[model samples]
Target: AGSPTEATALVCLDLPSSQVEVVARSSSVAVEPEYLSIPEPIVFPTGGGKEVAYAFFYPPKNRDFVAPAGEKPPLLVKSHGGPTGATAAVLNLGIQYWTSRGIAVLDVNYRGSSGYGRAYREALKGRWGLVDVEDCIAGAQFLAAQGKVDGERLLIRGGSAGGYTTLAALTFHTVFKAGASYYGVSDLEALAQETHKFESHYLDSLIGPYPERRDLYRERSPIHHLEGLNCPVIFFQGLEDAIVPPNQAERMVAALQAKGIPVAYVPFAGEQHGFRQAANLKRALEAELYFYAQILGFPLAELIEPVPIANWPPPR
Candidate 1:
């Protein structure tokens, strides 16, 4: 796989003929390719002395532009959905989207994520919120200890199951200064009752059988623990989503607003479990970038109207 500094080039190797065929060159918005940062694979120790894996992408590289002297770039830790899904090392424009704009990204493969053996994947079973949350926190600490990212500017984001982990991290821990959740689960009990058949019993393995472990669900659910969350948060939800449902995001937004916390909720009509419309996708991405810039005190690379945030405090 190509590193973050280099655009991914595709080539076909012919062993019998001892020949190499070039397929295509990777493209980026940056005029110069060298300005893009490459991804570096790293493993760090988490709870139980166990190590978790992640791909760290550094800030954008530009010959003419230099960051403020003695300034460290902020880090955005991404959690993949599925809770069972694993982040691949493949070249992704999404990762580049942030790095090219000066944000560092850490794509985590927390315990219970796939790609590793069954044992590692099963580690998340019956410990979804705790295991995933710890691994993400560990990854941030690992990067901060290396002095590669700003320790105080940590952020977390994810979709679906990963979104759940994002909310869990923001609510249960204070590691992240801000967070974004794309159709994430706020109430585990609601998810257990409302999710479709395919995943209706999925939590049975992740958090234990529902009704049987009702208390556990309530304890881990972020909606039930809004008092513990303090940082600013932005949520993107599909109004037609059946898996997580719109009410989940709505409830969380309402609670945060009631508490006078800085919160922004973006809901799209006619969208399903995930956004499919091009316009919606673009809007969501832009809104997230704008939201982060506003919260973190950074200038956005692109011109976008600001998304309204409720209960935001004036600059101190």
Candidate 2:
């Protein structure tokens, strides 16, 4: 019938603000340790030139969250595995486990990481320890300046290559109170000299060809600087991890401990590069959470099993 009368034409509608209602789901949702945070991504300036990328896991507000006009919550910034990896807005129960307890989590994607397209991802090529570590520190600063986090209480953690970032950040920056590196690389020279085939050539672009940039490897490795470290640190390494052998964590812990910096090294047997088993992952996460609470003095609601880390900072 007459082309179905064209069904419809343009229509104008004006809605009144008086009629509009806004409700913050989180504003009403009770903060819980398992899923109370929102994942957000933020970009920050790089010290040299390129931009750094990061994903934030914001905790549900106190609803009555009154900041006393100047106070801020503590922050836990994380880095993902694979120096080539990116932190998605994925629902990592571990992240929420912290947020629900009044912590903010930042899962960072440093230079040489993936998902920011190719150009940003390759920025760390031939400069692994420098750009990657700097970017992470920058992200923390950015969040602090936003009045979102207590800068002095900054914490950084990472797994695999991410662990490498955590170690570098703690070694290079003074902002972090504590840090955890999960099966991360500590000595580039050793890694390039003895790692399996898959990663043998990977560092060629990450740091430089082995033996050629040997100085650079030693210069950036965190294990060498444990003498100067004064912060609390913990390491989680899978005993069977072929990528970053347990020896890496062992050396780091021993060195840091010798220097009197609080350190805990847990090398789980039969586990691989990353702890995939539920129990191992669970213990790793719980241990890290409790370690931070004890070190940083932030009251964590969840009961973290006692994994004694000797000489931890005076508890809060």
Candidate 3:
């Protein structure tokens, strides 16, 4: 099952483990690098049926057929942007850095995403904020059930559409201990009302048609629901980002600050939606890791180029 286009429903099968030997499921089309082996699809029981989530769990190497003795690894629930994009085990030097350090990363291909065919991709249609948020929550739940991730040290991070899910997960749910967003959508209504040509009409598929679904655009927006967000968040955005203007980043920063949440907003001057300059990218990565380390009480790995938080301790 696959989606040729973006923001469509995903179509998958329910293969009961009891009949695994008899049932056959279609394979995914994502290409894997020569050095890596992709993990299998994981299913979590949703309302009535199972909601299939695509993920890659890289664990530490076993020692001489003996279980390693260490605390459960910190889990990072990664939500990819595009809301239409699927989280594949793509080759990345960063993912390696974390896994090598014994961190567990769960990249979620949530509802309303592509690569699952048309039907499953459409699972988020007209249910934008609520459905996608639920998927991330479920992904975390799946990790905790495995008993390998520290439930108390969970983090959710994403970019673009992925950022929107992160904001929603932090605001609408309490599963994550902290979160980070890169040029994510803070206001859905503003995006629908003030987007560029390529995506001006894109909301028609993810949520609903313009003018008709205007209410949804407002209600699903995280910016409008800042009052409900109480967790620590660190956001990065390019100063000149046209896709998600600096104002969106500023507003969220302001709201979180006013609510007394430990929030850090770093906008790279002259940078666009995606940070490309090496210095800026490096700063963004280090800053994000620093934020999570500070909030989660994780071991500090030589805090490089740290961005000091004015109000260090979060209000209890």
lDDT of 3 by residue, 172-286 (tens): 8788988999999988878888889887788897888888878878888888888788899998998888888889988988887877778898888889877779898778878
| TM-score of structure candidate 1 | 0.89
What would the per-residue lDDT of candidate 1 be over residues 143-185, giving only the tens digit for each residue?
Answer: 8998989999999999998899999999999999999999999
By lDDT, rank the candidates, best first. Answer: 1, 2, 3
Off by over 4 Å in 2: 1-35, 48-52, 60-71, 313-316
lDDT for each candidate structure:
0.85, 0.75, 0.74
TM-scores for all predictions? 0.89, 0.82, 0.82
User: Which of 1 and 3 is ahead in lDDT?
Assistant: 1
**How much lDDT does candidate 2 score?**
0.75
Off by over 4 Å in 1: 1-15, 18-32, 48-50, 62-64
Clash pairs detected, candidate 1: 4-37, 4-38, 4-39, 5-37, 5-38, 35-61
Worst lDDT 10-window in candidate 1: 53-62
Total clashes, candidate 3? 13
lDDT of 2 by residue, 1-316 (tens): 0011111223333475435233222122233433345566687777654555655546434443333565687888888777787666644556666665667877777777777777888787887878878877888888888878898889988887788888888887787999998988888777887788866688888887778878889999988877656788988988888778888889888877777778887778889987878888889888888888888776666566878786665445
